[model samples]
Target: MNRFNIVYYTDPLCCWSWAFESTLRQLREYLKDDCEIRYCMGGMLASWNTYQDTLLMVTRPAQMGPVWMQVRQVTGAKLNERIWHFDPPASSYPACIAVKCMGRQSKNAEEEYLYRLRKAVMLEEKNIAKPEVLLQLAEALDKEAPGLFDLPLFKQQLTDETTINAFKADLNERKERNISRFPSLWISTQEDERKSLLITGNRPFEALQTLIHQF
Candidate 1:
């Protein structure tokens, strides 16, 4: 059997990605040691000032509530749309950069932090763009898993040029690959890099399993 690699392109603030979390967990359990998954941050929203969604006509924060409601209705994911009305995040770049900072510590840290970030924004109604909130989440994670991250190092890397550049590379990769949606996956067997598949949008576990098997 050939091992596989999946490069998941997602944004921390993306509701669709949050909805797909359960399926992602199931996929990991099914693949186990046979697959290696890497996360690539897609800067979904740099700032509201420059944001525009012609398809949804979402030019302001309040308009995002309906989008989240639609995602919840379709995917059955727990989400609080009130955040968009009350405390919407101005940008997703901070959380994305924070995940990259966590990656400097360990892959586990990066994955765990990303999960927490999604949960915070989608379910907990937390504004993840704030530095204080990001640090608080990191502290909570540290309490849960001892030595998972170096507090000082993680904090330092939050504003480090290298970490920012790493996230920029991910954005560049997404642009180069023409990936405009969250939860986009690029999967390929270790033996043949040229032969690969790209899956986009939220999908059911059975659908994903069948697709991976066919690939």
Candidate 2:
């Protein structure tokens, strides 16, 4: 049997990840049975409020508008650039915590919750960074599975550190381990030897499926 440790690192607020969601979905559809997956956070937006006046927040999505179009051209996923004008810059940490919270609740539910989050923001124009909204999401997720917001676990479970040490460590380790690209795949041996091949950003499902089979 061939087993792979596939690490997916991305930011919730990242527009590229939004474009890549279909690829991510396709990657899992083909690889989940054959691989052990790990989801890691790479902090893309540190803070949203501090940039209340700066162009960093104001201009990022403006920049993303054309990028979304390009990504749509390539990936064929739906993204509404109107969100940039309608919603404020999300901190992405709260959304990240929500993901961790869902994962802590159910590994299976994590991706579903993530999908909901992306849909809420990217499609419906909902603000997912708010506790009320997250709580609502939590309620929806919890109805399907219980104790998701049991707090101490979500608080204590690497959510804080994933940004601080865990995130930095993962970045440094990726460099040391020589894994490049956002959604890169690093195949690992039982002895923990690593060989990586870049999957690149948001390609067709068939391309990723071939990569999974090649391993």
Candidate 3:
């Protein structure tokens, strides 16, 4: 059995990425031990002050509501678009940095923290850009899993230069790979180190399953 690696490039506040959660969960269960999934934060939105997405026509925060609604209608993912109107996030960089901090604890912690961030902004209408909100989520995770996470260490890492550098590395990786969209994947098999496939945007479970089989 050949093992595979999947580099998942995504942002915490991306609507399409949130919609693809179910598909990702199914793919994970189906693959089991055959694949290793690594996350790379794409820094989708650094700050609205200098942000202008011509494709999505999302120059402002309020324009994002219809985009989320469209994704919900198409993917049937439960999303609250009111966040854009109510407490919109100014940038996704803070949440992305928080995820890098969580990764210092463990891979599981990193993944769970990312999911919590997505759920907070997408479904719960919480502002993930705030450090206090991010810390509260970490505390909740600590309560849920007890000693799986070190609260003091996690808090320190949030502002540490090392964690911020790690996130900057992810941003640079995305740029080098020319990945301009969320929910992008770079898949490669152990048999060939130089060859890989890049799939962007949200894809169905069967499409991913078939792609894995081809490898």
Candidate 4:
């Protein structure tokens, strides 16, 4: 049996995840052979009420116009700042369910849809909280999200309170550990079952290459 699992906990709406994209992506490509990695959703927003608090949420992207330029320059990704005003604050719940929908409906397809969802929220600045936006994004994948909306599996899986609770519990557990921020990976190998080392956040290929060599 696989004794240890690598928990890659992240929020789809997190800015740091956007910055760390290039690096974490490299890790996935390079380390797939040596270790088992699974993608898990960290629900960043549970309700719309929570969004009213953050300065980033209530204001238009024009409020922090520099963030748009900075993120693009750093990550080489594009974002549509107008999404903040045109749509609502990105809730990530709909996108989360969209990912769950993909996971339930198709196996490999989930990852692709998840990446798209992340790009929509992080780079494109789309309101992922809205089902309509999520449905539209899913449409690009040739997925009929509107149909899935009524499906018992999607309704149950996507709207499951237990799933959110579980995600919160996992987040709490990780927080208690106080390891580091999102986009951080922990590797546990059979040879070393004692303690795990924290990988630096959003680094180059050399960082992951070095960590893999540690095993």
RMSD values for the candidates in order, in angstroms, are 1.0, 4.6, 0.9, 4.8
Q: Could you tell which candidate, 3 or 4, scores higher by TM-score?
A: 3
Q: Give residue 63's lDDT in candidate 4 (0 to 100).
A: 45
The local lDDT score (0 to 100) that residue 39 gets in candidate 3 is 95
TM-score of each: 0.97, 0.73, 0.97, 0.71
Model 4 poorest 10 in a row by lDDT:
53-62
lDDT digits (tens) for residues 64-101 of candidate 4: 34555566687776655566556655456666656655
Top candidate on lDDT is 1
Per-residue lDDT value at 150 in model 2: 54
Clashes of 2: 0
* Tens digit per residue, CA lDDT, model 1, 122-167: 9899999999999999999999998988988898889989999999
Candidate ranking (lDDT, best to worst): 1, 3, 2, 4
lDDT of each: 0.93, 0.63, 0.92, 0.61
Give lDDT: candidate 3, residue 71: 96
Model 3, position 47, has a per-residue lDDT of 93
How well does candidate 4 match the true structure, expressed as C-alpha RMSD?
4.8
lDDT score for candidate 4 against the true structure: 0.61
lDDT of 3 by residue, 45-75 (tens): 9999999889989899999999999999998
Candidate numbers, best TM-score first, in rank order: 3, 1, 2, 4
- Model 2 TM-score is 0.73
- Tell me which of candidates 2 and 4 scores higher on TM-score: 2
- At residue 72, candidate 4 shows an lDDT of 69
